[model samples]
Target: MRHRRITAALGAAALALGMVGAALAPAQAGGGHDDGPATSYTNPVTADFADTYADPAIIRGKDGWWYLYATSDPLVEGGEFGLMHVARSRDMVDWEYRGTILDEGSAPSWATDTSFFWAPDIRYVDGQYVLYFTVTDTELNAGDDSAIGAATAPTPEGPWTPVAEPVVPPRPDGGGFFWTFDPSMLADDDGSRYLYYGSYYGGLWVTELDPSGLRAVGEATQVAINDKFEGAYVLKRDGYYYLMASSANCCAGPSTGYSVFAGRSESPRGPFVDHEGVSLLDTRPGGTQVLVQNGNRWIGAGHHTVVSDLSGQDWIYYHAIDREEPWLSEPGGINRRPTLLDRLDWVDGWPVTRAGAGPSEGSQTGPVAGSLLGLTVEDPAEGRALRGSYRPDVDEQSGDHALVRGRVWTDEAAPEEVHVELDLRTRRTEPFLVRVGRGSNRIEVEVNPGERELHVEYGHGRFQEETTVPIPEEYDLSVWTALQVHVVEGQVHARLSESRLGDVIAEVGLELRPGILRSAPVELRGTGAHVDNLSVNAAHEPVAEMVAEPVRGEVLVEESFDDAELDGWEWVREDPAARVEDGALVWPLTGADLVGAGGSGGLLLREAPAGDWMVETKLTLDLGDTEVRNYQQAGLIVHADDDTFLRLGHVAIWNTRQVEFGKEVNQDGFLSWGGHTSGPPADTTWLRIHHTTNDAGEHLYRSAFSTDGESWRWGATWTLPAGSDARVGLYTGGGAQPETEAVFDHVRFYDAG
Candidate 1:
């Protein structure tokens, strides 16, 4: 169900009075926006900016983008429940909604209609993204229907594939006293990962995972005990692992008593003790209180995660009820908790925040320092002034070059003529269009080197007049080119110049229509073109100028595996038979299979793909004289965590050689689905996997295979559950004979389309 506001519209007089009162109130200690004595910020960072977001789990992705994953709005009467929603940010302040991670129809069959997703925790590990989330069935009692599940994706934003079963399923048999929900993960320095979950009934529990982080390996240990506590998060600091959890009811809006408490232990799997030597296991005293409601207007601050800014300052992100807009707390209202952020300071051996004064309100300094404020434009000395919104893609090869990589439009009125220089690199043949106005009343100057022509046209609704000139043979299409367009009186002139030669390659003129208005904005549309310098001049006076600066923290990973060495990869199982030959990774028959006792073969990329990514590799499976077993597979695998993953394999199934797509969830047996079969033999198959999210935010995996590396045949498409951060690479196993060889001809990973 979508979140709905419940407040009644205030009268004009009442609204005016409320605004005047708010303006007259004294500023609190850290509530002023100015660089005053204290730094503070208002509550609900996304209040008026977006829909209500609660239970925020934020992470700085490997791609340098910040991601916020939260529980979707509950289903309304007769309405379908939405999937877990995700929002993205470049600087963590202004956010753009990326869509939900999963939708209704994407969940597994075991998850009944009564179940709803909640509180997701995401982590990037060993080149993959893993998500642990809570799910509860409304059909069962309060603490009886909650469970925890896991999912994986190749990138931070995913088409996540859920593990076939819940990581921690509900015990309908009443085997455990507490509900399994609100999951958080901790990765220790020694390559060990631990999951901390559970609610008030059985206290907060901790269990270790077997490297993959998909399956629990040992018995669960209770670390914190309290009548009203959940959302357990563990943070390791200064040789101590801190246990943080929310206490009291968290979803009751203004009347809620939710707060944050903390305990610490030397070990991640802890016997956590408070500052006063009080054990969290002792329900008689609970953990030490850290943050509580301090001021009016804001209440019930809880369910938090801590992150550090570029300046090395710790900030706690959480959600709280806003009293002024207590729409959710009104009579017969649903809980509406909006996200909030505040600084965390360390005091002695424990963590403290604003002297334990809960959440803050009003203006405050942000966690990060930089701002993306728009450029200031000055008026030109001509008819209608113009401004250019310069966007750049700075790389080592191009140094500092403005990118007209896609369509761009400006609000400034179109000028009669615009002058610009471009560094058109090779491998691109698309024409560049300098358009004025839009739709029917539009005119354009097109420079297409691929077609070797230059033209200028004026028209309405695709009806136009044009003058075209063929490009001179002396002009090199591989280098830079200078272009100009001028419209004066009732004529239009266009020109193009060769790189370094200054030779005019083409020139054209066209008759301009009468009553033409210079009112619409100017636009540039093209692909694979870079602008080194650009300027718009009006009446011979400069109106706009652009200079480029390098963009920071953009590239995550660019691997070719061309050196015939595993430079940025970790072998899941280092079989001595595997070697590099002719720039390809060759895994010889180790007599091992991918299932049962022989299911031990893997090689994972070391860095996780941040947002969306693709992995392509050419594989040749040599079965030798041994017959291909039912599952003798060799191809690519996309791992979410450790235990949950998807394999797009070239295998021998039922005496037929085919490309198969299978999934493994929580160590459950693989659910192999047949893909494109009856193609060419497996000796020279090019396998590729593309993982991305669609417009509706569903995680989609599109697998395809090629015979000659040029033409491809589409295989199967799989929809992942709500969460994903996946690792991708090549794998080979499950041969009937132990001695089978799988050869991979280079593995490539790139950002998805």
Candidate 2:
């Protein structure tokens, strides 16, 4: 997500070279299957390319290479280094990381070196590649200071030349309500061009562009409106114009409420309506929810672009935050936003994804046109499964004898053990065996016929162990060599022999654990691998028991803060200023800001549960002799996204301390309901927030406060738009006084049902 950071001191040239070297590092061996050429693909088409790339725009150049551009970083609080970054791919599946295309030194003279370059849309116009991008001031705040600019290059990869001036300059103070950013160009069939830009501040606006696409010509027109909208992309299909835009905050770590919504209009610029006939201008409910965050592994899936593959299948490209590997920054932490790809399907008259689901996780089929070999399997229990994108190839002679080449992804948490039995024959020495997992946490068994050796390697993270033994001469490599493998509880046991269920030539055991391995796919790799009957057995089990149960008329959590450990609560960001001390959750003020829109510095604790719930905590603000600032707050919060939340806290209004309640709906910015008392009962107060389903079936959040832990006075109630699950927690930050401290004596959660 978008979080401020301290810029790195590396020069542009040095940074470019380092990125090149990291991308060119040799890939791991025997990743999954080894077939002829790969034909299938999966998400993260570019694995481990880079950590932080967002607003992906990809295009196939005339040079037969695919080029991808995105918002690059030094992502400093007040420094902009590399603007637009580029990566190229020959097969569109494996991308080569090229460095930044535009740096601070090469940017337009009018643009400050600290301006944030975001969301560039490129298209070939009039035989030249035209690039339109958004630029914001050093703070990267969306306001009148944001502008849209253009550049041109003869080739997709180029030393681009920026236009003498910005194509769409920043508006004068209070000139317009909308923020002029996230520019997208559409080339109409009637020989007209248009540029679409805007954010939730005003609405989506479109204006006619000159044929060169270098400047705007006609008057701007409003086509769509939504208080939670950004990232406008248009696609013309049949006789309708599809306007796809992202709603809510796209970069709030795991708490992000980002999703792609769609509306259609007959004209390129006209009134747009969702499938439910709801106008885009309606604020009560948003546009049709097309794609949302699915699965716990990947969250915040939005800011997307749709493209057609060589085989005519539509694929959606976007960025998602990996929950396990969040990006840390100076002020806050951003969930690792990596580029991901998924097939887009057209069902009825609307766009649909796989199984009508959202972002994909684990293993999936690759694109249709790649050279990678694909394997498909069907079982009475597992149904139909297809795996693609195997990098190696088996010998031609081995392919003739090969009966089954299986590639399967295994969930480490499964209760049942996995067993595989196959056969291998070789005319020459080669590494042939089965592989489980990837990277540092991997397990493999290799049998080299020519070397007459058998080896087993297994590891967790960087620590690993390998055991090898000379192969018995009785094991014939010219004929079928039976192999059987059993994996359970992070351990693998393998036995190899000349015949099925015959005398074993070698037996090896390797220790591995599922916790370290995560969810890793298994691959049978090597040449001369011949097997008639390949058996894979894994008994099915229900997943509900493995996950936290939903809150249903039961006490979900109750922490007294007496124990110095945060067992059930997780920190949203790892800040040194926050800790458990003296039987309370103590968050000391660091003079950091985490109060305004998209602010940071607060210490937050999150717990995920479904259904109606209430979270209450006892907050005590201790500033000693120092005073609190207007933005400083300590309270209980029901945070849905950066802009959608309900906070009931002890806040300072114009330096006057008060117990205030506020709500930010649909990312339109925060609004206080003005139900504050003179102060927070001298320092200690009970803060309570409730999230429940109203009679109208809409999700509503309510806050209440009390001087003591018993009696309460209800504050304000706000309705939530339709979206994913939210997190409830206690927060303290944004205080002007660096010595201030907000202590939570106890926190409790109860099912409101």
Cα lDDT, model 2, residue 457: 80
Give lDDT: candidate 2, residue 596: 49
C-alpha local distance difference test of each model: 0.56, 0.57
Please identify model 1 stretches exceeding 4 Å from their true place.
1-41, 49-51, 74-80, 138-144, 172-177, 327-332, 369-753
Which consecutive 10 residues in model 2 have the weakest lDDT in total?
19-28
Model 1 worst lDDT run, 10 consecutive residues:
17-26
Best by lDDT: 2
1-753: candidate 1 lDDT, tens digit per residue: 223211111122112211110010111223222221123346667664444567788775533456877775532222234677777775556667787787665665456575778888887544457788887653334443677788887666787888777677665536633468789887653446688898755568888876667888778787876343588878654346788887655653333446677888878877888765656665223355556554345666778876643222456778776644433322224456777877655544455455344476666565532211111111111122223433555533224555566775554554443222233433477887877655676668888878877767788555677767776544555554545454433545454542111113454555566645355565777676655323332211111111121112333455545665677787777777778877677786554655423356655556557656667788888543224364577888876654456677777643335455554443112322212221233467887776667555656565666667765544334444556666677777774464667888777666664
Query: Which TM-score value belongs to model 2?
Result: 0.48
Candidate 2: regions farther than 4 A off: 1-43, 75-80, 138-144, 173-177, 330-335, 370-753
State model 1's lDDT: 0.56
Q: For model 2, what is the C-alpha lDDT against the true structure? A: 0.57
lDDT of 1 at 609: 71
